[model samples]
Target: MFIPFQPLRTSSLSKKAPTSVGRVVAITGGSGFIGGHLLDALIADDTVSRIYVMDIAPTTRWCEKVTFVYTNLARDVQFEPQQKIDVVYHLAAVSREPGFEWNEYFDINYEGTRRLLKWASKLDIKNIVFTSTGMVFKAGPFHRAPSEVPSADTAYGISKALAEEALSGWQQSKRGRHVAVVRPGAVFGRGCGGNFVNLHRALRLGTFAYIGGPDTVKSCIYVKDLVALMRGAAELKGWHVLHGTYPQAPTIGEICNAFCKVFGWTRVIPTVPLNLALRAAAPLQMLNELGFSNPVHKRRVEKLHYSTDIDGSGLLELNLAPTHSLVEAIQDWRDECAPADPH
Candidate 1:
């Protein structure tokens, strides 16, 4: 059943907004992993009076405060008169590794963003918080500031960088409207999908093998912490372009060892050279190109070695420090979401 948006009072102390202040908010990709978490947060905020969720899919976890508006952002975005949105949280995109058509990335990431911004502009809806990615930067040991010009070597990064540009243009054309583009790291949590989820699953089963040296550092954030940053961004003014990542990231070996300790596993994890694994996974990756769902893709394997060191100092200036430690978040996910038996 479709229910109109309503704000309900809750006793939980709000870290960002004291109240949503009866704002009618809208979110694209509301049924998605990160979007879903943000939706829940909005529903809990008494300051928000209504929420319009525009997505192709439907959400099973419905509430009276949410109204799902079916939208194909790749084509066009339309909403009813009663659903006039005050603020927009654009989270819709095609964000997965392997097997994405070249046009699909542009169609969804670039065109979809353009279409949404145009539609929202027509509605005179100003406040926008777009969820971008840290992948826009080159893969290395370097930490980058949000003010620095972006360099995208991959199609995904290029599409997102273009989208950010479009949003920036829109912000310039208008007055008194703030645009926030948040580039987050590998976000992980219960029910979240990504390489981190796969890694945690393998670790839980004791079937995870070391792919490369332990010294490779990666920037990551808990989904809840990332969501908190998003909320903080929405409440702030001016262009909030910042990186949503851990202030202090842990190395791959350290993260893996933490899992072993949490799971009470004394067994020494086996390891393989990065080059050897990539060479072995090449044929499987070729099969993946032929429409096969190969788990071991060369690109996916390379992520094990790539250091995603993102500078999150910009967000600290916004007073949005990451609350949960990586170790604590991983343990919570394992205890709350892991299967009872993984043998």
Candidate 2:
């Protein structure tokens, strides 16, 4: 659990300064939540000359001067960066929530990643920052502290665990790659519309319900903080893993209470028996898998209990210094749903 989380060297302000204008970079899933935020951050840097946005979905708004490439990385498609790529942020994958078939998850999360990494190496790409999730550490001997144990709760965790292992192994050989692995916990931000977003909206509308008591802890990172970690990772070497999240580690009760505090509403949620929830969730989960919709069945009741403990010593070393507050991520979400400016 203890690792030297410091940067290999001191970073000067200049180094962190924008790369020369017109610097070209590649980002998969650029149209998605985290990806979109990173894209915006990159564009704000005066050093960035150009950004190559690639994803399965089209961007709502793309910079006129940037390059936009569309490709489904899940398939057997070959992808090559058209311009001189400065840094490659690998963020695209499946399993937006869960319930996909074993093969489908493998094809996208595992095989698709393998394809992208191999292509990058072949292209002599050196700077690669991968957006991995913290679930890789699930299935742990639960009840241990995040500071004490590493465990995850799903096959999604296993896929990422294996993927990181493979990537780190490559770095060991001094192969044609240097990687920075960013493992973020639950992420909420604008345009994410992820699993948590629905929950937030549901709770705000007074329709959301939970079986767990208020004390079920959850760890989450704001999308903006995740973007900062990705930028810092571009300057990393070998296999460096860091979690982009808050240290407070709020619980399920705390999350609901926070919503209540912000929205001025409260309702006692009825608890469904765990066994009943599990039995009923399987078929619903299967349906979600078939339709490619995120599954929030009975199994999720257990996920809320996952240890929110995450170490960020590695993040500190990179000087990424996440400045965004975790509450802000949710607050913005609430604002989006609350009301709009009259302008």
Candidate 3:
């Protein structure tokens, strides 16, 4: 149900009220993996008085401070929060998963953001924290800077880049508005079910192998650290874009070895040449095109060889260095999993 926007109640308090008092916050995709963690952080924060979660899906979490609002960004829907929001966290976007069309990505990621900004303008909300992707940059050995031109080749990346442009325009149109864009790399943690989970499963099943070499850089950040940076970004007062990844980018082999060491497995994973692996995966790719669902794909194989190194110096400059290293983060995930492994 679309919650109609309610006007803020007038009081004897001044219009130029300080945020030192508790602030009301709204999140676009609070049901998502990262958004769930962000909600936890806000619940524990003394500076936040209330939270409004707006998404197509209902949040699994229930708290006294949270009110879930059903809203779909992909559709042209009217939505206004019940409370006057001080900050909006835009975390809703479609990932570049299999079978998603180009228009779907554009409509949801680019146009969805435009719709959100329109609502925010009406509420007179000044601060926005958007979660973009490191895929906006080209994959390579060298670290990618935040200011560098976006070299997005996929539909998801292009849509996010366009959304960033729209946010920049919004920030410039107003005098006191602030927008902070965080382009994060592969994020993994307790509740994550992305590449890291697949990697762990592969390692445990003895199906994991090194493609090309052992030194292909894999830029990533723990989800907890990423949300912390997102919270910090909401407090900044200008247009800012930051890359979210470790300063010391970990290699794929190093990641695999870390998994082994943590799990106490002494199995030596084998290495396969890129060309040979591609050739072997070609048949599976053809099968995928023929409507068979399988894990092996040419694109997935190719990505395993490319390095996704990104520069996260901007995070450090903002005093938002991640609290956990790669190993420590892995250990934490292990602990969170407990007797039930990530697989």
Top candidate by lDDT = 3
- Give the C-alpha miss distance for residue 117 in model 3, angstroms: 1.0
lDDT of 1 by residue, 1-343 (tens): 2233343344211222233448888888988888888887887888888777788887544675666677898787765536456788999998885558777878999999999988988888879999999988877767677787888777788899999999999988879888999999888876686677677678777777777777777778888888899888887776778788877667788888776777776656678898898898898888877978768887778888778877886666668978777778777767766574211
> Residue 65: error of model 1 in Å?
1.6
Residue 251 in candidate 1, Cα distance off native in Å: 1.7
Candidate 2 C-alpha lDDT tens digits along 1-343 = 0112122223321133243447678888887778777877886777777676678876554553355666687765465544568788888877554556666666777777777767766776777788777777752223322243334456676667666766766566665467887778788766666557667667756776564445655667777777877887888766677776665566677777766666577777655555666776788778876885654665575665345556654555567746765555566666654573100
Q: Which ten residues in a row have the lowest lDDT in candidate 1?
A: 11-20
* RMSD after Cα superposition, model 1: 5.9
**Model 2 alpha-carbon drift over 4 Å, by segment:** 1-21, 75-82, 139-153, 267-273, 279-296, 305-308, 313-318, 336-343
Query: What TM-score, computed on C-alpha atoms, does each candidate reach?
Result: 0.89, 0.79, 0.91
Could you arrange the candidates by TM-score from highest to lowest? 3, 1, 2
For candidate 3, the C-alpha RMSD (Å) to the true structure equals: 5.3
Each candidate: what lDDT?
Answer: 0.78, 0.65, 0.84
| Descending-lDDT candidate ranking | 3, 1, 2
Write down the lDDT that model 1 would get.
0.78
Which ranges of candidate 1 are over 4 A from the true structure? 1-21, 81-83, 290-292, 338-343
Error of 2 at 67 (Å): 0.9
lDDT of 3 by residue, 1-343 (tens): 1123343335312234333457899998998889988988888888788787888887776665667777899776476555578999999989745448889999989999998998888889999999999988767666788888888877888999999999999999999999999999899987788689989999999998999888999889999899999999998989999888887778999899888888988777888999999999999989988999888877688778988887887677789868898888898889877988862
